[model samples]
Target chain A: EAGVTQFPSHSVIEKGQTVTLRCDPISGHDNLYWYRRVMGKEIKFLLHFVKESKQDESGMPNNRFLAERTGGTYSTLKVQPAELEDSGVYFCASSQPGRGSPLHFGNGTRLTVT
Target chain B: GESVGLHLPTLSVQEGDNSIINCAYSNSASDYFIWYKQESGKGPQFIIDIRSNMDKRQGQRVTVLLNKTVKHLSLQIAATQPGDSAVYFCAEKGISSASKIIFGSGTRLSIRP
Candidate 1:
């Protein structure tokens, strides 16, 4: 089976611009998660989606960032008026709906804002 | 805020020797712990996992030891090889946090010839 796949392995944007990252989870997976890791920092959770509904979004940093999983298949994260601090690697993962289930992650999209 | 952390930022081990990486977590409520290995230009891959009900779990050449008393976790690799050189991360998940997993700063393992 194919693993989780992320689009645009690398992205570069200017400050105040808008950028969007996409993630396609493994087939038949219902739980999708988004995570970000800044340079030299630990990977932090961003949000989670169970099917088309969001399960947890408390990890979202600010209002400028938005995430959606339409049709319950793929997810997209958008950052409007992006700031330098928004630059980081965004990872997407998926797993079966079970407690302690192992997560399968994508290669991640590296975003650089200048 | 509760967080997970590694004791060392990096480790160097000679080939054919065993390697141990240590991690400390602050959330005593965490019931599940896992370890991941990440190579350059790739996402993290699951190595091993241990639940609070068990003290140790082994898979192939890797072993994960968890001590709930001290909120400590460690990963031991036997017969370390060049391919084993990568960044290892320890993560934890608590029942209260639902399915969210907390990750720690990774420890880079370097194998010397």
Candidate 2:
């Protein structure tokens, strides 16, 4: 089976620009998640989707960030008016619904804001 | 992939030697833990995982040991090879959220020829 896939492996944008990152999860996977790693930091969770409903989104950084999972098949994360601090690797992961299922990750989209 | 940190702690091991990488997780409430290996320009790949109910789990030449009392975890690779060189991250699935894994700072494993 194909693993999780992310689009536009790298993106460069100016401050105040809008950028959208997309992720396609593995087939039949019900759980999708977003995480990011800023320079010199550990990967932090951003949000999660269980099908079309958001399971959790407490980790979202600010109001400028938004995420959507249409039809509960794929997900898109949008950053409006991106800032310099938004530069980082955005990773999307998915896993089967289970207590200990391992998450499959995508290569991630590297976002650079100047 | 983007470089996530300024300097990650590195472990250098000679080929054909056993290598051990350690991690300390913060949440005692975590019931499941995982180890991931990420090569340059690639996503993190799952290595192995251990549940809170167990102290040790083994997978193809790799072993993960968990010490719940001290909240420490370690990954041991037998007969380490050059291909094993990568950044290894330990993640915890806390009881706080559903399948939301939290990652550590990561350790870079360098193989010596």
Candidate 3:
């Protein structure tokens, strides 16, 4: 089976610009999650998706960030008016949460905001 | 509490020798834990995981130990090889959420051939 894959491996955007990161999870996986790691910081969860619906978004940083998983196949995370602090590695992970299976991660999109 | 930490930011070992990396977590309520190894420019790959119910769990040449009483976790690699070099991070799953895992700052492991 193919592992999770993230798009653009790296992205650079000027301040106040909008950027979209894409994640394709493993086939047949029921749960998809978004996490990020800022420079020198531990990885933190942003949100989760079960199918095409948002499960828990409490970890979302701010209102400018939005995520969509239409058709429950892949996921897209969009950041509008990106700030310098938004620069970090955004990771996409998937898991078979039904039986407590561990999550599998993708290479991640390294976003740089100037 | 509930913060995961590593004993050292980096570790160096000789190839063919056993490698041990230590981690300390602060969450007593954290019952599920995992150890992930991330190579340069790659995502974290799962090595092994242990629950609070078990003190140790083993995988292909890798072992994970969890001590709930001390809030500690560790990963041991037998016959460590040059390919073992990477950043190792221990994560404690969020008991408050539905299997949300929080990662540590990570420890970079270097192997001398």
Candidate 4:
């Protein structure tokens, strides 16, 4: 079976520009999650999607960040007017619908804002 | 604010020796604890997990010990091999936090052959 896959393994953009990261979850998985890790920091949750519906988004940093999971198959995270502090590695994970299911993660997209 | 942290930033161990990594969490409400391994250029992979109800759980060659009173967690790897070199992270999930899992700064493990 194919694992979760992310697009544009690495991205570089100027400050104040817009960037979008994409994630394709494993097949038959209903739960998708987004996470980010800045330099020298632990990975933090961004949001979660359950079959096209937003399950939890409290971890989203600010209004400039937007995440959408259309049709529940894939997810995209968009950051507008990106700031230097927005540079980090964005990871996507998916799991079966269960309380203790393990999450399978992608290689992640490394975004560098200059 | 709730947070999880590791005791050391890095560890160097001899091959075939056991390696232990420690972690501390501030949230007493957290009921589920997990360990993940991340190699360069890859995302975290699940290692093992233990619930608050259990003090210890063992996997193939890894063991996770959870101490609720001290809010401490530890992962023990037996016969540490070169392939085991990676960043190990300890994470906690609160009972009411839905699917959000809080992670700690990882401890990098380096094996000496």
Best by lDDT: 4
CAPRI quality level assigned to candidate 2 from its DockQ score:
medium
Which residue pairs clash within candidate 2? A40-B4, A40-B5
Per-residue CA lDDT of candidate 3, range A6-89, in tens?
Answer: 998999999999999999999998799999989957788899998888988988999999999999999999999899999999
Q: lDDT: which is higher, 1 or 2?
A: 1
- Local accuracy of candidate 1 as per-residue lDDT tens digits, B66-102: 9989989999999999999999999998874356888
Which residue pairs clash within candidate 3?
A: B2-B26, B2-B27
CA-based DockQ, model 1:
0.66
Instruction: Name the Cα RMSD for model 2.
Output: 3.5
Q: Who is ahead in lDDT, 2 or 4?
A: 4
lDDT per residue for candidate 3 within B1-113, as digits (tens), equals 45788889989999999999999988777878899998879999988988788999999999888877888899999999989999998988755446578788999899998
Q: Please give, for residues B1-113, the per-residue lDDT of candidate 2 as tens digits.
A: 21122123888999999999888766668898899999888888999999899999999999999988988889999999999999999888865447578888889899999
Compared with the true structure, model 3 gives a TM-score of: 0.94
Sorted on TM-score, best first, the list reads 1, 4, 3, 2
TM-score, cand. 4 vs. native: 0.96
Cα TM-score per model: 0.97, 0.94, 0.94, 0.96
Clashing pairs in 1: none
Each model's fraction of native contacts: 0.59, 0.71, 0.59, 0.65
Over the stretch A3-62, how does candidate 2's per-residue lDDT look in tens digits?
999998999999999999999999999999999989946889899999989999988999
Clash counts per candidate, in order, are: 0, 2, 2, 0
